[model samples]
Target: MVKTARPRGRPPKDADPAPMEDVLQAALHSFATHGFNGVSVRTLNRELGVSHNLLHQRYGSKEGIWRTAVDWGFGQLTEKLSAADDESAPPLDRLRTFIRTFIHVSAEHPELLRLMNIEGGEPSDRLDYISERFIEPQMARFQQIWDELAKRGETKDVPQEVMYFMITSGGGAMFASRALTERLFTSRPLEPEHYAAYADQFTDLIMGALKD
Candidate 1:
């Protein structure tokens, strides 16, 4: 019989790791659910039922896994959020793009915010990694637009953080807390159209309030 081929670099004792993307997604969920300290590489291996050293072999440690996973999740949001950054677009139009895009993506990947919410409870190196890498950069871009609107008297002097809360806690709250929404709004359809409608409505309310 022809010899069977073995996957390269997957030593005798070490089984092949899942696709990196899938691994990161699962790791993100685990971190979101249990918090960083509550989970370990062994925990993930057990959860995946792979070789005990599989994650460690790939990630080197829990910190590495957390970084990889967090980056993977935020990378998706960052890409979609980029659609709002048309330099030729007017300031107000860009701002609307930013807000509505955020809502749509939040609806699509609530896990991104969920992971942040979990890490937000207490400050740690993990928190620093996320804040410095993802949170601060995204907020900085939005902050610049908000300042321009304030200068034009297009927006109130509402604290930037407060506006952020309005978006996250106000419009995105349903997706962020999926369990409650599923229970409360049994008839609601989670779809692209639904995301667009909510984003448009929320953006209108905020834009109107700013103009008022």
Candidate 2:
């Protein structure tokens, strides 16, 4: 009897356990670029050089990966916002810190904004999940801060929802509109200094408007 050789090309399944964080990062980028329906397990597997079985095992399904990716992205933003909003600081200072931190994070992770834009343009379960899990909670926290400022008469009476929308959508545009920003500033590439300057200007503009 002749002994048959085992498969040479594919390694044993246990040989390479998937690095979950790396998978999430890749999934985040893919979902951000392609939205929910545009991405597939096969595509992700090919891109990450992992098996579809691994992704399924880790996330359960494509929707699971989408949910996880959205959670991961917003989790990062929430942490940054929480750190920036120091309760020990004065309200205005805390507000400034929050705005600057938000702009900085937006610049660093433009993919977050892109993904949100894509989700906002469509009506789907993925969008509903993001709204419940991320958007509503963050907006509530922001409204709480504004309410405190209003009680102290530091800020004028403005619609909290409008202000929240302006802060996120307007600030996001600075980083999201890369082509327009680059064309507008043809002499220089957008760097850290540019983002810093924009943050300062954005804070000043919002503060001024709120006071007025």
Candidate 3:
């Protein structure tokens, strides 16, 4: 498949060139939609229309590219999550911030959850890599927020595991269920302004349920 060329406009001043950004995004979407076992460096190069030897030279193998793409994705998510708050707010407010931040990120990068869902279907090193490298650490931060909320009497007596899934999988499904969303809502990709509004509403809904 020939990748449709996107416009390459001039970047703003001091903008660091991320040459691999598009490649990693495409790789994530491919892995998400097609499954890890279904994709390869050869397929990536063929679809992406890059030099046949380029990905192999840079990444060494399909596994290497998969790891790098996954890392790039989670790294961006972690950065966005960290930028949402500085951890100085109240427990409840911090929880709200987390919810909003996640919702926005979900809208921006639905492929992330899709890829995880595919990998979660069966045991594999890919599953383990994402779990240990990304999911666990992020969940730890979520658990910290939950603990703080518990201390402040802001959260209910729900199991932390259930709450975690409710936010990550349940809430994210509203956005990440792209096939459904496109049919019911719009075919175009979600933009930041629209996601910001959705995040506000979604965050309020979660905070309402959590607050005593």
Greater lDDT among 1 and 2 belongs to 1
Note the residue pairs that clash in candidate 2.
Answer: none
Compose the digit string of candidate 1's lDDT tens values, residues 46-68.
Answer: 77767888888888989899889
What candidate 3 gets wrong by more than 4 Å, as runs, is: 1-18, 186-191
Task: Quote the lDDT for 54 in model 3.
Answer: 79
Per-model TM-score on C-alpha atoms: 0.87, 0.83, 0.86
10 residues in a row with least lDDT, candidate 2: 185-194
Predicted structure with the largest lDDT when compared to the true one: 1
Which regions of candidate 1 deviate over 4 angstroms?
1-16, 191-193
Root-mean-square deviation per candidate: 3.4, 4.1, 7.8
lDDT by residue (1-212, candidate 2, tens digit) is 99998878989654686687778888888888888889999999878776658888878899898888878888898888887787888878878887888877887777788888989897888789888987788777777777789899998899876887688878877577777878897525457667777778888999898888
Model 3: per-residue lDDT, tens digit, 9-112? 95532243236888888888898889978887778876776767778777888888889999999888888888886688887877888888987888888888
Task: Count clashes in each candidate, considering only residues at least 3 apart in sequence or on different chains.
Answer: 0, 0, 0
